[model samples]
Target chain A: MAFYDSLFDSLGLREWCGAGDKGGPMTMAELLAKSKGTTATEETSALTLPFPSLDNLHAACEAIPRTRDMTSGVENFFLSIKSSLQFVLDPLTQPLSWLLDGSIWLFIAMPWWLLIGITLVAVYWITRSRASTILVAVTWLFLAFIDHYDYAVQTMAIIFICTGLSVLFGVPIGIAMSKNDRLQKAVIPVLDMLQTLPSFVYLIPLIFLFSVTESKLYGIAIILYAIVPVIRLTDLGIRLVDQDIIEAANAFGMTARQKLLSVELPLALPNIMAGVNQTIMMSLAMVVIASLVSAPGLGVLVLRGINNLELGVGLVSGFCIVILAILLDRVSKATLARVDVSQDS
Target chain B: MTANVKVSIKNLYKIFGPAPESVLEHAKNGVDKASLLDQHGHVLGLKDINIDMKDGEITVIMGLSGSGKSTLIRHFNRLIEPTDGQILIDGVDVMTLSADDLRKMRQADMSMVFQKFALLPHKTVLENAGTALRVRGFKAEEADVEARKWLDRVGLAGFEDHYPHQLSGGMQQRVGIARALTSNSAVMLMDEAFSALDPLIRTDMQDLLLELQKELHKTIIFISHDLDEALKLADHLVILKDGEVIQQGEPQNILLNPSDPYIEDFVSDINRSRVLRVRSVMQPLKEAASSTAGNVDYNDTLEDVISHSDGDTTKVYLVMHEGEPVGTLCMKDLVRALVPRVPSEESIRS
Candidate 1:
């Protein structure tokens, strides 16, 4: 540290690197020592550094930045911007809460049989198979028989709202990305972070920004986690369209909009549908985690099961989530297969 | 025949890299293709290309792969913009056309057939054929009626409702041609359109194209890597090597008098007797030669004349065109013309 002091001093960096009181949270060791109102015990080391080590550099030059400082700096920066973010994000996000709440109410108010009938009809229409329709019917009946139909509907409502929003916003973003290299370069890292970042890490920030009572808290968290796949796959799908086919369209003198509509989007449908299926499954996965923020659903029952150690409640609710996922997956996959068949034929 | 020049490309340079403009100077100063790429990290796609495509004739651009033949064809439609050049179509500079005008030009003036067929996989053959019309804002019904005519012309009438994948490769290419024909543009740009077909199918397509060309008389720019295809289809031939025009003229003239070693190499192994037509080697005559073996069609290949002669060097046949004697083809000159003027290089690789 004495060596670093002289080293930094000779380089004319001492003014910034010699301060002791940078206004921020202290390191864990400093915090602990202060809380105990005593200097922490130090063990003398037999081995001595031949030169200035990083620890001594931090000690002897208190202005030298530490890793914690950088993290807390990011935290402080977010805290400063949080109100403006909420101001902008809150009004924009209010409709999402309404959509979620409205869907949940609509699902619940309808008699269970009517909802099941509509769902079965929709599935049968899309898949065009009586066996799949019967399978969906049996699954719904089992949920009702177990008295978890209401909870199951709540989860489906959330997934429906979130996945719909994801596709609605995600698709255009994906299209824009596919059209522009600069935008794709800008979006890809953000998408990568959203995808690979631990789901709860994003929630930590969202929890601070929005209250648990706001439906958008869970909605936003679920969307942030679930939207990545659709956006990624949509971009990939558009990019994967045959260059020769695109050239053919261009040779016909297709305008940009005409080409996108009649050629690119139609060709990319199977991939986009696959993206939606993944988004639905991911939304279902995030729904259980979203229950930690007071999202009402079968997830609530599962959490209650976990907290109270009731194995039966957890297993049944978990099974219900699996059934919902399978229903979504099968319907979407059937639609994808249909598209493929039509294109292939 | 004094045909009007339909499409004229002049002083075109295309350098394929980040800074094509900066490298254009070097290319203009006679920096060859490989060294320019090696020194400046730029690919010389085309260098000072100049060609006049006459109306109502097939101008076959002949080259092996990576010879800028595809690049040149695309420049006509601005699919790949030239680094520097003027493309004059009917005396209007294509490079200076506004975006809307360019699209208008492509829609109203030209259509293309692609090597891989490039048919829209999702669309039925009818819809794919109607693409140019649909893009031009024709309603589906209107486009359908128009497209049906071309599809019928291309011999795919009953297959209108079928998807591209459901058809064989030859059938798919017919749909490609139908799509081009349906556009009804005067210029047809075929970029290796039949290269994907089997050899037998390719010859059939060639015959089909020639038959259609005879009836239509549309200005066509056909790109081919195969010399035989070029000789068969080209009314005017432009040979390319290393992104430069090595030689260009009538295909038979190019065969008779190849100016570059590359062009010479290209024609070296071609079935010379089969490719050389009687009209190319005939001595112009106001009357039939007094010596009489028989009469031969002006368009007949020397192979036909050779068969007619029965290997007799003294036979001379009257070259007939439209039932009139235009010239006389002497077996002695034909036999001498069969030998190469210059000895070809040894071990010509493929």
Candidate 2:
């Protein structure tokens, strides 16, 4: 009976009066009377011979055009538009190249040891732990000994810039998405596409539009890659806020903007901060990948060692990246912990 | 008693769905429930709710879950807009208020406490309490000062810096209450505000609310599912069921005579005499009562009157509203009042 029901449903025959009946075909009047809860004593069955086979079902289905054809057409249209955008953007990419070089040079010229010292102190102050401070200091010293400080600093600069941009752009987008369902629906597919696409795939079109020497090339790529976490976190944070709290805010006569700023945002701060942490981590991950395009960092050193077969250089560069990752992770985690503690008491 | 109604709601209907207005339009044309359901998956959250919340009175709307009690109160504050109705606050149609005006009305005239306490978890107790004032444009220092005063009023003076999650359920509710009161809104809407607390704490919170009401004289609209809480707190009680008002009257009247079988069933288990108090059911005391019975306090319960009297010819003393003697009762009358009636054998068997 279930199989027959499925067959009828698949064939779109359920809309007809005679379908879905197990007691053979019945007249429209008989079906209506049965639906109305009237008893029908007389039973008249109509048996038709030469039932249509599965091949006929398949043939009928093939006669109808599928929705996929329209989707593919839309996809091709978008592909063309993207390529056209890349062509227009190429000439504007050169000026950004000088800015990237200048920023890298500035970091390279700084007294690398002093930079490491100040970072250690800041980490210590933020985390408020002697062990974390010592670990940060030791990691920097080890990187300096291996002569990977310059590359590590370059990577740090990219992460700092990208993470900052991600927070700036992602938070507001998240807040907007939380407030408006239509905006959320519109933005979510884009976020999903960005998140699921391979990290290397992001650089392909970006490489076409922006020169590898441009700081904005890596900047834009890192932001695109890292922005999803912050946006998601912010949205989740605001969405997770108790509905009763929002209602309470409304009852208090808070304007929509006031409520978002004062109540919803404050309650969602932890989630947003967590998103910031994730964004930073993602930025660091993408910075290494950006090194392939001549963006300077520990990744550049690692790539150099791999290409030249210098085992010591690769290991040293890898160690520097780990130290940098620890520093950023510790500082952000400490900030988040402080937030939670302050909220508690 | 002659003060004009502060809030007047007429035929309020709040239906939740995309096409609520269209569905409501069909509903008014005598569309059957099934047809309405089929056309639009409309859930009648609130239906034809009419109420007048008098100035300085605590009106309690009581119902089981999904009975539209919460939705009805939400309509007055415009937290949830009614599909079709007129809600007048101080003679202004609340439904027609512009966004800015509505916000101003909320900030100045109404505040609400939620059952979950809804204290901002990120803000300190002081900041949470001061939020309403801050949003209404008070300066930081001024808001803090006012917030401290309300926090002190709610008995949390020393815990201003503490956050909401650090506080117990009752304490959190106190913070919520303080926040609502800090706004100094004439109308305070509390949605099951103390229902989440332990029984003892709930009683304390209830007492605190009564004390606050005594001093503030705010027009309070309190929503609760508990009948006892409603009876204890409300000046006027509105009983709702399935998006409709089943009964609305003074607590005393409703206790004495429930309007429908549903209400009768609802109040059937309630110990009426315990809630009624000496003031409600007291009669005139007679001069001759002093001869046969021991003198009982005029304010004592009937149970107290029964337990203290020891003699076989025990006479029940009647307490008058005023100081003068009015009437007396014997043991026979007291027994009749205390006993619960049982159905007859024939009726039970049938």
Candidate 3:
């Protein structure tokens, strides 16, 4: 270890240490530190790598042209393409913006009693179990009493829109990927980079391209971060379709489009729905992170808690997020269960 | 058309590789499947296959695994493309059809029953049975009615709404058959269609298929690895080995006069008495305007003829079809047919 440290030292990275990149650009390491606690000192952060020589490695990372050049290049790339991308994207994303804005307004403006009553009825309709439905009603009422109703409602609105958009585009792309092997091979690595990149890394390029004030900024981040599950599961669902079944469809003279609609999509519904459930949860996960970009709701409060170190504010909002997750998860999962039961019968 | 030849294969070859077209010359020149793969990178899936399937007959192609029997059947619907071949069905070359024409060919001319009962797990049995019609733009109600008729025909009338996973394997295969029948296509492809069923259920399905065939008279092409199944279902039998048809004719003829050692080995262990029809062994009609001990149908198995004769050696029987004399069968010829013929080569060598 000492020999390796000395060897790295001779590479002359010492000058780059403590250059103080104080703009708070938020590295993947900072995200980790944020998750643990928002109060880790800069000195402690230099210990991110497990090895003893990580101090030198950190300084070397800043000095390394490969690392610095790539990061800055990516940000610039996103910035340069912003205008054209936004133009092409606006029409496609307008519906998404409308859905997000419309839903948020509707959720926030509804009376507390009306909202709670509607939620209860919907939950009962799905689960048909008085017990689960009551649990839902009580959870919502608890939020109302705690004065977190608007925040919870705001979070739900974002989740609903982001997940809806993710499924809308993700399923067809996944189906296309399933049909074409070359496309699947090419697109899978892009999906992998999207998924495996640090969750916070998604916001950086969008922040550079779209102003922090734009609703589309966080909306895009939530979708890019959350859409992976539905795409993966939809692809898996279609690919896992029985080859013999496919041959039978072919033998029966089904056109490709007919086969997809009648056989592949129907058979793949359960897996796709499961994928939707995960996408919804992932959308919620991006909630607080997305709040950093001026997106509203419970996440804003969590960010407030972190910035001001207000334990009560952070913990309360975190509790509301959990409540929202469990409620959304239960509803979608229950619906998926119904689909599975119908399949079995 | 052309003496009732429903489908014809003309010098078909299937070489599985990136450049099967480039290797066609070698495969055409009798390069064996093994050497094609070992010497070159191509796998010879089928080689020089020529067959004529008549209308209203079950043409059963029999081969062990990797003999390309399955590959050959798939070519009828163009599910598997051939390297060099022409497949003409009903006097039209299927190989030349456009995508829409090909789809119409499959929808109007062919339907298939699978070995594993490939019923959609999500759709109800009725919906599955109606699938072929639904694909052809039939109204849901129209398709359902058509499917229900065949479902009843296949003895699955009341189980329409049940999903596939709810049914047993045998019952699931019944749905597969019902689906094929519901399509009302001129051609039915059964790729080892009964090979996956229980033994008792397999026999029942076979009988069901035969009963349906007698009434419908569809041009059926069946692929099977089982010699017994091939012998039982085939009206025109094509025996395949290593992607080549070794010998094919009436099953009884192949059993009686195996052209080579490979066929001899195939028929050697077969119970010939159960397979050989009396017409295969009966003497051509000699105009004896007289009565015989009994009347036998031309399609009667030799076993049935024996039981009709009641073990009497002197009894002579008239082989009839539709109450008309086709041939004469005596007890002597029946007993001789019971004995397996020793090939001339084997006898000479011994």
Candidate 4:
């Protein structure tokens, strides 16, 4: 200790010690006096520390305002922005509202059963399995028996729009996150919040922001609720690319842009496609919840059944949702399987 | 062939960190290795590496893992940049080149093959080979034509349409070799290119590389941890240990007389008779024709001498160097050279 003391003294470190004291521990007046090398005058008023004393904690608590709401500004800002967006989108949402309306004329214009048959056949061909194809056909026939086919198509339409939009927006964002560490850090906490939030909670604020009659009101909510898996999986897919492959690309003198296009993205395709499948399934899950905000779907029949205590209507609509889930899951999974085979070969 | 230097590196250093400039500043002030490890925690990948690659010569960098051989070779095409030194391709400093110029140099003057073959998994063999040319802005048809030619050269002519996963390890490596050769770069950097293949396939690949080297005369820098592979292919060998050059010379010279104890230990178990050629040890056949009843090529191995000769006249043979007789060695000398030396009793007891 003495040796260290002498070493510090010889190095003129005592001044640095005092400087550290001023920064860390010393009182402001003491620090000021040390800086100026002067004492306080008799007439100078004493300066008090800003921190409350332990003995006076109860008094401090009593003195502070109880109604000091800290999050008021944040809440107000969010509310205003949401309302303004809804006001701007109201006119643009009219055609979608009319499309959602269940009229005889619209039903006559489109033969519902024929459309169902065609969709089932296309799904069968894509999935390349008779069981899944027949399952889809029978499910649709049951939906028609319960007069929920039209409502089921409405739900499917919403799911198709939401899933397409989710993949389109989510994949690019995921890729961007994979490429940029700072962006990944920024996005991960938000993804965590979205994934953990109750699915029904998504519709609560949107309902206040937009009218229940608009299709996009629920459309936006369902997309927000379901888009997380795709984005996360895409990021994971790209990140999971073998580092050796990346180094090889660099050795080949491929630019960063070229490597991403030719190597990284292609290798990550299976994971990204898996993410898309998850997103589609999630979109289906959110559709029933979105029906609370007047989303026209098989969900409407389920809601009606629940409201009226009709067991048959509820069971039929629930079965219809299951059939749709299987159809989408089969098609997406098959596509992914094909991609993997191609990549392996 | 005229001696043309294809690649030159001078005192290259690579230190990884966020503040490379500050890290380098500290590193220049004679910071000891342990202290640098303590302060910055940088894995000193390559340190003060200087090498020159000649045209049409296969230079092998041999080292254990973490010896910086891969990092050192990667600096040639700017795959990894040197923290301090200059890498010159032809007459231009690659470090100072513009991005476009670097890409052009890599695309036109240099190519690389990786240990894992690094073929694009989704693309067919033809597409993988053609990717470099396509990136270099060649038209699809022209790129395909050139790719097919190189594929044929690597003996995978009919398998162009098969994807990488469809090919065997040997076949995939062939595709990798083809992809590299397709660029038509005078210099090719192969970083343990056949290390992942089975022994038989590895030998075949080595033979293929030798065959390709003969016709193209490409300046090649090969990296390997395997000593035998280095001896088989390298015109010049650089042995690295703990991020420093231990020994560097012709493969025959290094194999015969390693410079230090570390190098000696590294080369100790090597089959010297197989690696050391008669040209390295044989006395010239000037006075030897009258002395010995039989003729032996100066380039034959000592093993060959023992295996081929029969009668009692096999007492001593003169060694040759460049058509001039250099030294004389008898049957006893051959036995002495073949046997490993045992330590004396005092050394053994210690």
TM-score against truth, every candidate: 0.91, 0.80, 0.85, 0.82
The digit string of per-residue lDDT tens for model 2 on B1-350 reads 43668888888877788888878877667565556667778876777788898999999999999787877878888877789989998888998899989999989888889988888787889999998899899998999999999999999999998878889999999999999999988989999999899999999999999999999999999999999999989999999987888899888678667777677667766665466544444445535556545454455555666566653434655554356555665656555544333312323112
Q: What is the lDDT of residue B12 in candidate 4?
A: 75
Error of 2 at A334 (Å): 2.6
Q: Taking the tens digit of each residue's C-alpha lDDT, what string does model 4 give over B206-314? A: 9999998989899999999999999989998999876677788898788667676666666666776676676565444445344643445566776787776553435
lDDT of 1 by residue, A1-345 (tens): 233455677888777775567566676867877999986444434354334654456655777667766677999999999999999988998998899889999999999889999999988898887777888898889999989999999998999899999999999999999999999999999999899988888789888888889899999999999999999989999999999989988888889998899899999999999999999999999999999998999999999999999999999899888888888888788878888887763
Residue-level lDDT tens digits of model 4 in A1-345: 211334346767656544432122444554686799775433322353333432122122322221222244556777879867777777776554454453323543578767776777787667676766777787778777877767777777777777877888898999999999999999999999998999887877777777777677877777787899999999999999988888767766788788888888889989998998999998888888777888777888888889999998888788888888987887788768877887764
Poorest lDDT segment (10 consecutive residues) of candidate 1 chain A: A42-51
How far residue A193's Cα lies from its native spot in candidate 3, in Å, is: 2.0
- For all candidates, what are the clash counts? 0, 5, 0, 8
Candidate 1, residues B1-350: lDDT per residue as tens digits? 32599999999999999999998999999998889989999999999999999999899999999898999999999999999999999889998899999999989899999999988899999999998898899999999999999899888889999899999999999999999998899999999999999999999999999999999999999999999999999999999888999899999999999887777777888889999988888899966478778899998988988887889998888888999888888899998888877667652554
TM-score of chain B of each: 0.96, 0.87, 0.94, 0.88
Complex DockQ, candidate 3 = 0.49
How big is the positional error of residue B262 in model 3, measured in Å on the Cα after superposition?
A: 1.5
Q: By descending lDDT, how would the candidates be arranged?
A: 1, 3, 2, 4
Residue pairs with colliding backbones in model 1 are none
For model 1 chain B, the run of ten residues with the poorest summed lDDT:
B341-350
Question: Where in model 3 is the C-alpha error above 4 Å?
Answer: A1-98, A124-132, B287-293, B310-314, B324-326, B343-350
